[model samples]
Target: MLAGPAWPHSTPPDHGPDMTLDRIAQDLFSALRFYSRLPTPAPADAAELWAAPDMDRIAYAIPLAGAVMGLLGGAVLVLAAWAGLPEFLCATLAFTILVLASGAMHEDGLADTADGWGGGRDAEHRLMIMRDSRLGTFGVTALILSLLLRIGAVMALMAAFSPIQAAFALVAACAASRATGILMLRALPSARKDGASATFGQPSHKAALSCALMAAFIAALLLVPLFGLAAAVSGLALCIAVIYMMAGISRRMLGGQTGDVAGATQQISEIAFLLAVLILA
Candidate 1:
């Protein structure tokens, strides 16, 4: 954009925000702004970030934002358990908190993705359908199935493990799956010429790798203790596999990724990880 050499893959070059005493912390806050309803950096702190690169690199921190979300939900589960609520009720309240925190952004994506891909006969038709705000048959079905699977898996994990263990597992699943969204963003071009996903730009390989390692570390720390090394490995693999499959589908059907596709990928990866936990935990 500065009239220099072009980036490969047509992705916009990574533009760094002004470095600060708390650059990473600020990036994390920017990520929260993008991914959830949580409060972020104050106006003063946010001003510089908005000036240069915008939030192009914030994708690297999405998993951290998701980890925060998951930990908050886990806290809710623990509090509900302490209050003597039934396991199912505790699980319900925890996930409900998460859905509220994220504004169900990723869930909305999955539904729209399903409708677009399922109802359209061609890529153009599918992209147009996806751009619509209204829900349809496929969207409704996808939402119902995704919600049931996610909630059911959480309840089962609660039943199968201690509150702390279950909470850790949930946190790990969330962190790992959300990273898939970032990875997907980096791997594909935007299907549309311009939108949130396209404008966000592609993360560098190093940034993507850092996000992946952070996700893997979080998963390994929490899951290996409860489900053993083998299961933990498999579960993380499952989440990544879901990302790969979803990315493949997005590429085939829509030509590239979009904000909605990234969101849908998060939902699918979250469910896949949870299902893996249900089976192996």
Candidate 2:
């Protein structure tokens, strides 16, 4: 496994002589490994890549990874809809594909964050609660609500628009939500010394900006054509609002950002984006 966080603080080992296409390809693979359960062939330096993922490079590729994942899940949604499946069942199946694709990493983060934020006495206590793997009442409730809300949002989108249009919305939401989540690395300090956020190292402003711009491009390319500029703009605004709200909550409760906070941000922003599409479509 990736040993203690030595490389995150230093020059990453994966850097090559230059930013060639090969390097960009490697970074994309690394991003996929970091963000999802998708099977990827190990590069020659897989050990070093896993040890200290160069978030600076990987950040740029995260939106693309999310877009790929969205396409996979959205394909299921489109096919099910075309097969005359119930909209609710199609939505649930699509959501299940997404959860399985990512191994529910974001969901786990959401649960831990809610439990810690809702039940802890202090920042330290909250961190402790988050570190515990056991599910709590707060976590259970948050997990259920998150799943239900997203599925419902998908159902609404299908009702309001065609499944193909809703699938594009899913792709845009996935890209945008992940882009929003990566900004936390720039927005707040790491909450714990050895936590995942800290171990992964803070992404520089340029990296975060690149991620955001790429996602915005993806959103515009996918969403604007379907829902119009106004709806797209509104969805983006709500995504930014989610980032700010999550940042404030994380700063107040955990004293900074963590993996869980990022996950929660993505989940909430996704719901916000889908709802915006449903309302406007």
Candidate 3:
């Protein structure tokens, strides 16, 4: 099972005040540690490995981390297709790598959110349900549907175009979806006084904006080559809409954001982005 989001009990490296290249690189490393199960090199001060990520500082680097993560999956997709695998199998293989690499961290979050929302009678009950490690029927169903939709969409993309094109689409979706999670984190208050989301803390407006801009720029660059400029813009707009709607649901249903809510935001927005591109293509 994917471990829960790691809100480590450590501190940031003293990279000084300026946003130096070293600082940015460190933040990207922090983001990878928090967001994925990839074997990133540990910091020289190993204690920082167990420290809570400075979301405000590292949040802007998340999309960059996501782009790196997605590129790995994309490479697998390309290689599998080159080896003459069917589109369905190629997409599935690539997606499997992505899930394994990330330790299904976001998938776990999506399941928890679905269970909490579907099973709870109120905010407190929902939060309690989310805290339970066991998956409910609702959670299981959500996971199945999410996985199916994502895999099928990738297959469709590959069938319609070359694997290279589909791989870039996946990269764009991954970057934009994770960036939307930052928006959800910024939009809602912490649902509880404790836990990962609360301890990880909200990103500042500047950090959130930086993340959004970078993600959008990256998505546009990759997507425009495959889809027209208009389609690229439309896909991004649809993704933002997904974030807006999810944020509203999170606020009303849970009274705030949890780690699960943020995870669910990423999973769903990724689906929306992929479908938007496919439909517009």
Candidate 4:
């Protein structure tokens, strides 16, 4: 359907257009990498700011944005805990912040992927099922279960460990979950001809590996100083195991990867990270 990947790679012309920095910033925001040093303009009322040249760079940006947002959400949780907020409330607030920041993009992907895989009998059928916009029973169930598990795991960790540890766990889970998406994108072929995933799914392996390392380092920074280096090592091992499982599943189900599969990886990886933290912390 993509006609041998003939998508144009030319940079947009710089002449005669009255594009505002807001437009560029919106594009970068969607791309999700390289935060702008320029001042963000006054808020606009429309979503037009999100339009940008969809490409591999933007695909690459998604995880970076996810990692940053994960860190921010983690920071919020830590601050709330430090301020004496209840563990349940802190966990809820941190999860809510992540959902708000990412517009639930990964969650939607997870639901769609679950519906597709659970309902379909074959690779072609799975791909078609995932393309549908409507959520099936499996999708709904997967979404509920994943969210509940994540929240519950974080809450349990908070109860068992210090609030700071819980906060670090949240941050690590966020980053590791997104790193799963990057890993899958790097390892698998796109399942569709045209879609957001297709547009941003073809990032180089080197880029993905770099992002993964950065995420691991960030997680380590958050965990090692607080719980000792063993905690960080355990977290990294868990993240790697989760990614490996997702990779196998992706290959078996669709012969490669779909946008929904990538989403599923993120969701599953996040859950895995939280579970690991709960067990190891």
Alpha-carbon local distance difference test for all models: 0.81, 0.85, 0.86, 0.69
Query: Candidate 3 clashing pairs?
Result: 8-51, 8-52, 10-51
Report how far residue 126 has shifted in candidate 1, in Å.
Answer: 0.7
Q: Which stretches of candidate 2 lie over 4 Å from their true place?
A: 1-20
Worst 10 residues of 1 by lDDT: 1-10
Candidate 3 lDDT, 1-281, residue by residue in tens: 21112122334334359888988888889899988888787888899898988877787799998888899889999999999998888888998999988999999999999999999999999999999999999999999999899989989888888789989999989998999888888777798999988887777777777899989999989988778787678778987887778877887888788889999999999999989888898
Candidate 4: give its CA RMSD in angstroms. 6.9
lDDT of 2 by residue, 69-143 (tens): 999889999999999999999999998999999999889989999999999999999999998999999999998
Q: Write the per-residue lDDT of candidate 4 for residues 1-281, one digit (tens) a residue.
A: 11111122334323344447755455446545222222334335445344533443343344445566776677778888888988778878888887877777788888888888899999889888888889999999998998889888887877888766777777767766677776776666676767765776565645565567767777787777776677677777776676667667767777777767777888888888777766765
Best by TM-score: 3
- Backbone clashes in candidate 2 total 0
Candidate 3 global CA lDDT score? 0.86
Q: Model 1: runs farther than 4 Å from truth?
A: 1-21, 43-56
Q: Which stretch of 10 consecutive residues in model 3 shows the poorest summed lDDT? A: 1-10
State candidate 4's TM-score.
0.77
Q: Which ten residues in a row have the lowest lDDT in candidate 2?
A: 1-10
RMSD of each: 5.3, 5.5, 5.5, 6.9
Residue 207 Cα positional deviation in candidate 4, in Å, after optimal superposition: 0.7
